[model samples]
Target: MRDAYHEELDALTDRLVEMTRLVRSAISRATTALLDSDLQLAESVISHDEEVDRIFAEIEASIFDLMARQQPVAVDLRTIVVALRMGTDLERMGDLAEHVAKVARLRHPDSAIPPEIRSTILEMGQIAERLITKTGSCIASRDVESALELEADDDAMDRLHRRLFKILMADDWKYGVEPAIDVTLIGRYYERYADHAVRVAQDVVYLVTGSRTQDADLR
Candidate 1:
């Protein structure tokens, strides 16, 4: 019975990793859809978000069942807690990606990003993907050291976000108010997406070392 319980714990980790994969793809596709103004790709990202949600729901159910059936302590308790937090962050990342896709759909053939800010948005998307990829690695390997690196990657995203606002606020900005609003919302989605990825990586640190140093700073 103990063996089965351990397997269940491992399964939770597996599910979390799967969620990372799904959200990573979602962000990547959303970025492309935004850049290319591809309606089909944007629609796909929005619709597939339910799969990520479903996996998170399963993780929550398993964690609850484990808690009910067995008294988790020490590392086991950390595992359950970390899994819950990580699952929540990953689910939010999925939603952020979906939000980006919705913006793309709203604009349809016209790109929401103006030429002046296109490169900055693209870089933000790239950083987001990098952060989520490392987050997945941290969760799968339980590597505290590697998990800590996500903070720096998130810093890059934040820098890009600031740069995006600078461009929008520049005197030469001629896109008018509507496109400016879209750019602002899109930048915010990418920034929040990176933030959630860092949070998940911090959870990996907690899962391995029972430390919340990085997580505390994030809050």
Candidate 2:
């Protein structure tokens, strides 16, 4: 019975890691769709987002069932609870990716970002991808070092966000109001995506260190 229970826990971990990979793909594809205005790819990202949501629901239900049946304690309880939080964050990240894809779809044939700030937005997308990759690594290996490094990784995204705003607020800005709003919303989507990845990595840190007090920015 104990062996079976442990196996179930391992399966739960696998599900969480899989969700990370799916969301990572979503954001990466969404970024490409945004840059190129690829309607097909944008639709694909939007459609497959349901996979992440389904997994999140599964992880939540499994955690609930495990708690009710096994009464997990100490590290076991911590891992289960953290899995729940991580799944939630990952699902939210997926939704952000979907939102980006929707923006691309809405503006079909025209890129969401203007030429001036395209590079910055591209960099933001790249940083978001890197952070989420490390998030998956932390989940798979329980690498507390990589998990801790995510805070600094997130700072890079923050910097890119500021650069985006500077471009928008420039004295000679000529992109017009609709483009400005699109870029603003795009920048925010990428920033929030990175924030969710950081939250997942922070949860990994909490899982390893057994301290939730360190993460004050989980939102």
Candidate 2, poorest ten consecutive residues by summed lDDT: 210-219
* Cα error, candidate 1, residue 48 (Å): 0.2
How high is each candidate's TM-score? 0.96, 0.95
lDDT scores in order: 0.90, 0.90
Please provide, for model 1 over 1-219, each residue's C-alpha lDDT reduced to its tens digit, 9 standing for 90 to 100.
569889999899899999999999999999999999999999999999999999999999989989988989888988898799999999999999999999999999998878888889889989999999999999899888888778788888888999988988999999999999999999999999998988888777776666676676554
For model 2, residues 113-215, the per-residue Cα lDDT tens digits are 7889879878988998999999999999989888878888788899999988898999989978999999999899999999999988888888888887767
lDDT of 1 at 27: 97
> Where in model 2 is the C-alpha error above 4 Å?
213-219
Q: What root-mean-square deviation over C-alphas does model 1 reach?
A: 1.6
Alpha-carbon deviation at 105 in model 2, angstroms: 0.3
| Pairs that clash in candidate 2 | none
